[model samples]
Target: MKLHISFKISAVVLVLFAITVGMLVDVPRLDILNESIRNLFYHVTSWFAMVFLFIASFVYSIRYLNSGNEQHDLLAKIFVQVGMVFGAAGLVTGMLWAKYTWGAYWVPDPKLNGAAIALLAYLAYMILRNSLTDSLTRAKISAVYNIFAFVMMVIFVFILPRMTDSLHPGNGGNPAFSGYDLDNTMRFVFYPATIGWILLGLWISELRFRVDSLSQKMNDDLDIKSDRLDSIPRLDEE
Candidate 1:
């Protein structure tokens, strides 16, 4: 696997350092959340990173539609793929934090359910995209779907959660972690953690795109050689 220099390795090291500090640093033991407040560094930051990744994907999709550039289409797909992983991580960490705070890994809150549905929408993209065989058709259709998926994600993750009363913080009139929980102290770790994860996501996406590009080139070369060989006169055909 080739590591791309575009993301830079120092960012990864900084992220690791930030994570270590987040783990060792003392956090406020607030009501219900207790020691689990440390999860703010990870759970919240992962969602932040996921949102950034999805936003990039949405932008690339739009570019693909306007310019008809296959690179934009590829970027749109790669960002979605990486965003989904971070989204899943956020969900899992939230579940664990919920287990500690709410006493259940699964809950009936609108926020939680909406997040799950949003992820499902993106997962459908992979399935729908692969079902198409033509590259042009696949790119156009997937680009349009990416825009739809981003809208769906915003509605499910942000809009719907606030529409109803819920146990989750930042929902049902409850103040968000930043409003009352996160202080300047936590921000030191939290901000860096978010930046680190975003950089890491971009790094991974770059490597994946490079691998895909090389694979596509190899396939195209093979197709050209096959065509050239077929054009030569065979004894039977002659």
Candidate 2:
């Protein structure tokens, strides 16, 4: 009945429909990439979702630091968790694609290394949040750490990869893709995949935030009700 729940269900249905249609329709691929580039739907979509959430986390962290709001910190933390899930999914899909195309499961490629480091940095953020006992302390410390981690994510995921050689496309000396990797037909499917998955990620993260916020509110309300009942005076019978 809740809007968040309804949105979640809608997201699932939309994703399924998109996947079905994407598979059914034929997209013209470039000569070099061939059909192997079809994996872009999943790989690029997941990374786009991850980056969007990570940017959200970074903004919220700055907001929390400027305004001293715990909700911002909590929201940022939740978004980071969601981002990590998306990043992991991207990594797995990338590995699978690489296995088929590059004939290797793992490579010390700059982009891959950077992506792994970025994921670990965010994972460390989660661990750091859980380590503190006091809520305020946890929030303050985590906010600082998140700010640093976000900076590192930008550096590792973008800058470092550009400076070094990578097996992955869109990097230096790699025979991967240039601006021509994604043709017009693939762009049609790819754009929707990106937007749909990012929207789906937000839908899930928003539901998670609502569940947590509602649960906390419910607990606080119950506590207040219990205290009020305890404070009530009873009249003695004559």
Candidate 3:
């Protein structure tokens, strides 16, 4: 599918707007959080972007299973790869935010543990893909695994976090990014940041898909050339 020029322009504009507002907007001085609350525009948005990418990956995995189309499989894999990158970024930023707020970089928080486990599960999916040699087998098995993992990840990151106590907001009776926690000024920047990050993730995934497609085509062409060369009669035999 062709990517629209407007989409790229919009992604760029939104990202710039997010940065401008994130930095310029004044935030209330809370007890422990203080200025670190500014990370809400970045760290939280990264996970939101990761979740969006993973959902796309899950949908494409289902499409691949139904259609048996390699393109769908390629898209699913690219989305997961990009999602993993965002997940890692979220983890790092979360740790940094934690250090300032919770007085430790790596606390034994349920949400943090869940995010770590979920990321490891996806990493295992990547390893599984590399271990398989046959393309069809790899795609089919990976699609099944991807669907399962996405569901588990949702439970880990979304459901489980809410059920238990978490240093992070929106869990354990803590206020979420709604109402007073996210004021009118912060909401304007936070929502845009979430969308901007998701768009950036999609753009990155598209570029990876194109590169993979080109590499596959080049390999196919080389294989065809090799077959033709092999079929040619040997000069000595002739």
Candidate 4:
């Protein structure tokens, strides 16, 4: 099979299998807790993917700054967009889980707050990218902003949460990955889910880059064709 055809089929098959597994799997009951832990698979996986994409975006941002190449900037932008999608998914999943477990859909907990702020910072990154008219200016400005947003995301989501009191474990002096939280069964699925989601995010970012490049090439070709036509003169005898 051609590579394109094979990739399309494989993507469809993987997504369908993921849905089936997600629907059929039984969430394990921990100790006396009967709360549904199924959300952990999607929620935690999405956050993992988001973190990986954000890190990739930051790396590309630095590369763009060092080399002044638009390719790095383009990759950085696409990865940030992919990260926002995963972050949004994580936020929605977290809210649902919190509602069931904490008796509230939304809480002012440090982890939740920090996650929201981090999402907003990236959203601003997109906004900043769009606001600039010149390509070079946009690349430089967005690169600087990407670096700042990355630092803020790390500080708010990872560092600050560890320092404060949070309803979520791993925040407010309550470290995450507690013994109570991890089990053999959860780990078996959790590790794969994390890797799978990261791989999926990278795949999506790659597609976005191809789409952007293709569009630019098409527009350039159209412009060249238009100029060629304009250079031709119509006969006045007619």
Compared with the true structure, what per-residue lDDT tens digits does model 4 show for residues 161-208?
787778885566554443445446555556666766776777788778
Candidate 1 ranges beyond 4 A from true positions: 1-7, 227-238
**lDDT string, candidate 2, 135-237, tens digits:** 7888889999999999988988889888877778878866543365444665666777777787798887787887777666666666778767664323231
Model 1: per-residue Cα lDDT over 185-208, one tens digit each = 888788888888898888888878
lDDT of every predicted structure (CA atoms):
0.86, 0.79, 0.88, 0.78
Query: Which segments of candidate 4 are over 4 A away from where they belong?
Result: 1-19, 22-27, 31-35, 173-178, 181-183, 229-238
Q: CA shift at 47, candidate 3, in angstroms?
A: 0.4
What C-alpha lDDT, on a 0 to 100 scale, does residue 176 get in candidate 3? 69
Task: Answer with 1 or 3, whichever has the higher lDDT.
Answer: 3
- Please give each candidate's TM-score: 0.90, 0.84, 0.92, 0.84
Pairwise TM-score winner, candidates 2 and 3: 3
Superposed model 2: Cα runs more than 4 Å off: 1-14, 28-33, 175-183, 222-238
lDDT string for model 3 (1-238, tens) is: 4467787778898889988889889886678778888888999999999999999999999999999999999999999999999999999999998888888999888899999999999999999999999999999999999999999988988898888888788887888656346457788789888988998888898889888887787677667787676554332442
State how far residue 60 of model 1 sits from its true place (Å): 0.5
TM-score of 1: 0.90
